[model samples]
Target chain A: MQQTKQRLLTGNKALAEAIRLEMERDPNVFVMGEDVGVYGGIFGATEGLFQKFGPERVIDTPISETAFIGAAIGAAAEGMRPIVELMFVDFFGVCMDQIYNHMAKIPYMSGGRVKLPMVLMTAVGGGYSDAAQHSQTLYATFAHLPGMKVVAPSTPYDLKGMMISAIRDDNPVVFMFHKTLQGLGWMDQLDASIGHVPEEAYTVPLGKANIVREGTDITIVGIQMTVHQALEAAKRLEQQGIQAEVIDLRSLVPLDKETIIQSVKKTHRLLVVDEDYLSYGMTAEIAAIAAEHCLYDLEAPVKRIAVPDVPIPYSRPLEQFVLPNADKIFREAIQLVNE
Target chain B: MAISKDHLLWMYETMYKIRCYEDKMAEAYAEGKSPVFNIGAGPVPGEMHLATGQEPAAAGMCVHLKKEDTVTAPHRPHHHAIAKGVDLNRMTAEIFGKATGLGKGKGGHMHLFDPDVKFSCGGIVGAGIPHALGAALAAKKRGTDWVAVAFIGEGAANQGAFHESLNMAALWKLPLIVVIENNQYGISVPKTASTAVPSNDVRAAAYGIKGYYVKDNDPIDMYNVSKEAVERARTGQGPSIIEIETYRYLGHFQGDPEVYRDKNEVTLLRQKDPIIRLRNYLLNECGVTEETIAQLENKATFEVDQAYAFARESDYPKPEEALEDVFV
Candidate 1:
């Protein structure tokens, strides 16, 4: 199955399609979350799921994330493949105990005897008028937990593949699909640039980063939409006669350190671009690992292009000014190469 | 109808073990040998809800269950664990937070585990009920005669998990025994504070399941009432809500200031303590000899002591193992 043959779909729409396919294929698979069934998700990732799967499976639970997640954990323990939508990435704090403490740890706590196999889908990022409470890339928190996997697929295809893989995995998975990049508009660009991805329930086997374009000057590591920005940054840097390697780390956890390290070693410079704040988080973790293994490989100290430490202000200029765009990434890549 | 001598004996044994162990735990907690628990962390004043007054309900109801059958309970689960055949040594070790403990020192005393003995302990209040529902669903799927029991206190019965579990179990016709022990209190607030329906059984009509209420203090009566529930579940007739009307012999926890209740209330409840009632009945009516009773206590004490030793001697988990079991 070629990638372009896939019809128009957003990351959220692709998720909705996969939810339908998963429920269709497995009698035991059920999708549950707030408004997922009737109103679709708050972001509409589960649109039409209820009509297709019925209320029994596409349950609209009360605003009790902890209770529902815990119930889903129990149900998964009882052999149901439940894909739970958490509405937004930031609200994980409300049910973090169930996620990190209970669902993430049940399998190991049971002496390698239990498999949680629950998929948690949530919308992450700043934009679309959703305030600070709703907008933030907190995948790092889940990535740090043991016995859990965090996948933030930036496109429709990877979104489908990663969600399928997450559903099939025996351990718990938190799939953080970004608000800005979910949909089919990126398909043509991704197809033209990255080219030919295998279609099927094929797992891209987690912990691997894709080099959107190979370069020998600087390695630019990007996450989610930041990867797209990095690709544009690479194009601009190419115009500057400075070739930049673009690495999209699809999954934050089980990080594809080797790919990033090798890219940095070849490029001899490193720059990371993430939509998250330039704080003690995923970028910090990646920078630490790069410093530990491939610091000398870098001709310059690694630079991180991120949102300044501030709330994602709801105003247009404030939001645009704070977000890490291609220009910021391009400037950083140029600086790393120049240094 | 009165329960058989074996039933009474089982109740006494479990009650005694729970009381003795909890008493020891309280002493340990006071001595700072246990984990640091603030005021509201556990059913306090009492280190554990020894449930000294509620033995008959646990022992009598679970006496008929087979080893393969399962039970999911909350922090107040010492009685259920014992009744389900969890090894006292491992149970004690779990309470002691030893790696040899069921949860490998992760779950602490609040988290108990013994799938071999068919009992799982939940640290959260109502969290265990859904697992019990799942367990019953598993039993139903496996097409086994085994049934799962959700042992909850009055407090736990008010949790959303309990509500969702009951609704789901009834909706699916799962073979589950929802044993809601109404011991008059959910940690200070009386049962009246939480529910208008004093008996959980009335809620069964809402779901179309059969319901029963037991004089929870009488092990024999509890056994008799629970017999129908067990039989109903075992026969694939689906679940039933059975509320046992019992009393806690101690405060909601040990060392409770107990300012809420009068000395007379405690004295009156103690006068009809289930253990004493069962023990006296067994001796006077069932002709269980004092020698046999003494032997049982001795054995229980020895076993509790052995569990303590195992917990004390078991290695603490290597710090790395903390992250190891997060995924299995």
Candidate 2:
């Protein structure tokens, strides 16, 4: 693969660039959402495309999530690749039928005869205290459902590359981006979110995990913003003579279990950090994987940190207490290593 | 139907209370959120959807309802909750995440549930339409005159639930009234860009139901139109749709940049403020005394102030309380 000149880009701009390049490359590709047009996007995922492609290509639908999301699946079935944004991932309740029942099942329900090639991109994760409805990173909820390819990118480079790859893929892909990583002026952003994204389009295939850090004592697995939190925790753990390896599980549905298994095998300990709920979520899934594959290799029971099975609270104090942060991760990592 | 003196007083008092509460809420929402407006920084953290300019829709329609009737409101729900007679202290405490809240701090401002007054609201755009329909169905089944009202924004009228619920209500002849508070915008997207028809009342025809449109933001107009609709529902005719051209004085959420709308738009809308119009009508047409008007204003201020004080002094729920209420 030929690499192009790299420039500093936020996670949102990288995503927008990927969509722009894909739309330019393929005439069948288009974008639609609540505020995707004129307002760019509430999270800036579809910025500048509305002006470049106009309303026809970058359409703005009503607050009818079921209608628009279902329309995306229908449009995809007819050969047009629609990259529809559902604004917030929390709003999936109204349109989950169209997603799980239709969008996910169409390809298999038709026995591969009808290919519903589309991307359902939405803003996920909760940190700035937008309350329960506005703030949620429902990764496991979507991943638990089969048929959709769920990918949540942490940095600009991976977001750009994975977005391009998701567009070119033949299956329905769920692209989840965190609001804090979008690098918008209003919200406080993480330093790790801004990275060198290649000017030209590239493909980072889905279902592959990136080993962001290497260690020997334990493996810390995370996705989206949790990956950054895991890395921060790993850095703090290094001072205490504990070397923790970090794995960014970019894809959830087609999970990179091999990478996780190999890393856990070498380390003999594992800690899964997730922003989603603790019960029946990504942590449980990863813990089950380790228990199934390397039951003997695990020196201690698989420790996991996540939102404590509760709706994202609105008040700052309560919200901070429930959210999975670096301090919580570090404390949990220490406990895992000691155990 | 003629607007009686008592009805006029009730409308004015309700609208005044809503305005006062919203004004105080806006001030409280701005606390700890200055210089840089971090949404989570304030004492009242999270999104605050203030019903600043859309009080008439609630006052006019709710003035006709009883305690047994159910009212389901949208995200911007303070006006409807107040008009529907939800306890101000508990509702305010809920917004402040206090244990004394309606849902014991578990449900925030958008998810206010007060079974006492049979009032509840949801954060989702059109999610409440079906809930109102179900309530209306139960009322019809129980052989009662209890009606259900769902107050939704113009943008929500385009939702699938809105259409589905309307069709079901019309088919079953349920006692439901759908009020479309056409406040022009759903966040940044204007109603013109979102809805297929100019007014949502026209969509009511598709369900074979009577539809009424309120062009002005006048409470009298809203009240007169709602009277017929309410009568039709209570008499077991069917459901009705009322699309009121209201106003949203503030941004979609507090601290919104609002680049999509013109800066002067809110100012222009405020010139013909519904509260002021209603007050003038009461004083001039109804020959109400200025002292009586002053008394109502003082009462509204006093009640709103008490509610705010109660909310501030109340303790937040124990952190462990979040684990509860997921089930029974």
Worst 10 residues of 2 chain B by lDDT: B319-328
In model 2, the runs with Cα more than 4 Å from the true position are A1-339
DockQ of each: 0.33, 0.01
Candidate 1 Cα RMSD (Å): 5.0
Q: What would the TM-scores of all predictions be?
A: 0.81, 0.54
Residue-level lDDT tens digits of model 2 in B46-126:
999999999989999999899988888888999999999999999999898888888777667887777678776767777
Cα misplacement distance, residue A109 of candidate 2 (Å): 36
Q: In order, what is each prediction's RMSD in angstroms?
A: 5.0, 18.9
lDDT of 2 by residue, A232-316 (tens): 9899999999999999999997899999999999999999999999999999999999999988999999998989988999999
What's the residue-level lDDT of A89 in candidate 2? 96
Model 1: residue B236 alpha-carbon error in angstroms = 6.3
Q: Cα lDDT of model 1 overall? A: 0.76
True contacts kept of each: 0.31, 0.01
State the C-alpha lDDT per candidate: 0.76, 0.87
* Tens-place lDDT digits, model 1, residues A70-118: 7677667767788888988888877776787677766766655567778
Q: Is the docking of candidate 2 incorrect, acceptable, medium or high quality?
A: incorrect
Best by DockQ: 1
